[model samples]
Target: MSYKGPEPRRYPTAPWGAGDSATAVESGKLPAIRPIWDVHIRDTIVCLGGDGFYYMTGTTGDNCWAFNDGVELWRSRDLKTWGYLGLVWSIDRDGTWEKNWTARAGVPFRALWAPEIHFIGGNYYICHCISGVGIGVLRSTTQRPEGPYAHVLSDQPIKGGIDSTLFEDDDGKVYLSWGAGQRIREIKPDFSDFAGDWQDLAFDDSGIDPKAKKNGQPLRRVGFEGATFFKANGKYYAGACNKDEGRYSFWFASSDKLLGPYAGRHEGPPGGGGGNLFRDKAGRWWQTFFGNDDQMPFREKPGLIAVEFDAAGHVVASADQPFKPFA
Candidate 1:
């Protein structure tokens, strides 16, 4: 049978197998490939905190494709054990314009999609999108991840795009890109508003994906959604998601400049799409994972896959990958 929507949220009586033990993870006895927590989450994003912890947030709620609450977060010291931070931001209490409901295909849909938490300029900020509406950013007043958060762009969204992501360059300049890297703009140093107008980004080479077509022609963009940006090894990388042979794939393209005429896109990690990439406290590269396709080992649960740059600076699955996807 074909898939419908996400499985209805069911509260577990007791915690299920929460991956390997913390000792195993710390001692390097196990590879970090399993779901960190058993919960229904999509577009999982993890960022290293100033206090030496990893904070994770994603598209969360009972029915995210329809309606639900605001952003929920989880904290981890070792990446093996996660502590729930509860609903840090709520649409009902904290949202100003974000509380407005928007309809999707004749259905009233209002849920936070892909809320990314980042520690930038000595403070914590979250950029999120509301389906059918647009994207908005929030800042932690107390400089904490579990924020008593407030909207940076008051009473309106920053832009009309989904899967909004923030990338902080080495010089501490922050850029916001969304909708699979279709548009990007620089955010002000104070997180007030866009410092510059949106620039369109595209790849030089068109990727082959049978499912991604526009007016009977193949789409040339990286992927249809889930834009991620990061600078690695002195090169800027823009990543997004696409379906290849029924499996969700993370595709990336690189360029010397931020606003790219990026090189041709290539697949990064198979079955690892709709997520972002980040380095841990130890400076090791990793990609956030929440399986979105049947080829994955599991579905709709947060997972992590170790990644490394190849000789050509392409992100690929690391040699220590534990939970390999099905062939």
Candidate 2:
């Protein structure tokens, strides 16, 4: 099942035209939402670095489903103005086990998907998955966000799944979860390997997604793909992408404990699937966006939406959401 197709473009040029930049909506303009960068990306994630900048990266490339080079990145100071850092990690150059291509459903592809940047323990870490392969974590050799990144696990994937995300708990223990948050395991403190056995995460009120069913029965899970995990307000939140009534959306479940019997499945931020939630420097909550459905304001461009947790501990888009696509 190796990729035998023509050599795809390595680090395809971003479609940004002259004078274009990664600019956010004007400050203090509560409801004026706009795309940060008018470039193609999916699984958008933004993380605030210890050096006082926000780093953004995701599934990039012209035809990511077929092939692409590696992880691309951009940085912002106040989440307003951004500057590109170019391809920080390349498959053909830096990858050891990750360099091999594989076929998915009879189609040969070798693209990186959903590479999320996390500033954990004063260093940057990226967890990503290859299209038909498994997931791996990379650490910045120089402790910078744009790194000469090397594998945390040198010769193998950390797990076999997609949309892998890392969560650092209050006690400083980091855990890895993936495949729509269906399975989770703690990573060793040194980022070398898994620390324990895989644990299943369940939702007490998991509902069936009409679009995703088996045997004519609806499938119940947090989401079909693009898993995101974070801790906010002392509760562990696990989120993933799902289609709600044909609209790509973000769904989440919360648990008092890390390995939940997480309760309740609720949709947050309509048209905001395949992205993660993050807090800005001012401690304001926001969710990444890359419109993936027809009903959205735009498609395949990186955006952001203001969000806040409800009284019941559910993440919900704020009334003053900067980008109200559904409105």
Candidate 3:
């Protein structure tokens, strides 16, 4: 396949307005909410449609009741404003499938995390966590933004058992990457089974206690699960949760090819980009991911932050905050 140059689209405007004239968290429009609490946003993408518009969705909290803790964060186009769209899977509180399995009499469905939706092969596929059931997919028949999506595949867990993300490479190949245990594998054309075999893409080698150890825990260093892949300037970039603690940071790697030999600086080991994205829109780069801790305390609302990135894709997080919308 011939390269198509940066995927033909750009992200929504940065939280603050554009250019060098605005201030961080511009005092006009209401702040964009994370929708799920506790669950720090791992990856984000602009969902595009054939009709010339885009939508938004990400794995946050459970659709039931968790801060930013939703199955999918629903956006109403205008990016700044959003609403809840329930769970992508059909397992409601009292559905046939729910009654037969997870909700049988009293059994409950547990954590659902890192749900990423993408449009592929003329259909939409939602890759998410169904607690103990492993990485799952929900397909939408029509090109509609909202879906009463149903599970198409649930064979096995993707290693870490959650934070599953689906990436379709430029070569018409699809791959699934997830956490709890970091893994990556090519998926069949149907987005069902593994295309070839599953492979480990990240990890924490030291086996030390991930929680108690300070900043040097190797066990916590590379255990990232929320994998998001994007191509730009002849490179494939995969960004994911850096570690389970210490400010919910993220790490990124670049490869000349889609899947292997990814090389870059590791976050915990030394120097590296700490958060997500290095750009926003209109050639303006905004580093973003998780801001604060958007939970019970409104002040602790872990919003999204966007900063500027240098030509080498390095973020200067310590620089003066930009006068952007989501400051």
Candidate 4:
């Protein structure tokens, strides 16, 4: 891997249209809502699909470590209001996807985590990640926001990579970026396997070591998970979440091509955390991230923020602004 260091991205930063959450509340709605209020969805992906609806899917369960429930998908038309669609498919149905599964306290669930859905080639492709098996691509042609997807990746190309995300370039070339030791792989045209070798997306010890500790707590390796990749302004951008030193924050890197020596992987605008970026009707960029709170003891709130490319060629987010339920 040729690491050429950071680039100059002079991106701008501002809020999307002033979304009125207060107006919705006064009109009799929730001030803030955590869709699946019970379990913890540490990471997920949400996007405004081609079908003109906002679709959200994430890892959820009956408890902390068990896959009691499979991945959940939610749909919202107005962004402010959301409703449960159903599981893209669950472990309850397919017990052979994962190995070494033992029953736990409650009803047993399959070991599924960090499932992401991407719409491409006029079809829905889900980048489903199981706990220990590998990442598989599920495809659906049903004309529904929530998909009745089928396992398309018989080869199961990527192994040991979690939080896998799909980014299709302007030329219809597809790339998969996954965390838990960040790596990128290009899918073949047939979608049966990866086209080439897996490329290292992040340096394991670029700046931080795995055993390093900060303020007494162990600091996470800089190669965080839940990476969302996209191409903008003729450059490849990869955004991920990480703990610089025992603290959670959003980070991103840019490259000149689909796979390259990443440049300037760093945190987001001040006070922002992990978020998934999406474009709006006006072609403006906005991100939806969770409030920095432990869902176990407190409520986890999700909100939207605007992002722009700075003049230095860096992506800057409007972190200082408050999250609005609607946009």
lDDT (C-alpha, whole model) for all candidates: 0.77, 0.78, 0.46, 0.57
Candidate 4 lDDT at 163 equals 69
The TM-score that candidate 4 achieves is 0.71
Q: Write the per-residue lDDT of candidate 2 for residues 196-226, one digit (tens) a residue.
A: 8888776665454444456665334678888
TM-scores for every predicted model: 0.85, 0.86, 0.61, 0.71
Model 2, residue pairs in steric clash? none
Per TM-score, the best of the predicted structures is 2
> Where in model 3 is the C-alpha error above 4 Å?
1-46, 59-73, 83-88, 93-109, 155-160, 180-182, 202-222, 266-304, 307-311, 315-327
Question: What value of lDDT does candidate 3 attain over all alpha carbons?
Answer: 0.46
lDDT of 3 by residue, 142-221 (tens): 55656666556553344436666677777888777666324567878875666687775543234334453567544422
Error of 1 at 261 (Å): 1.7
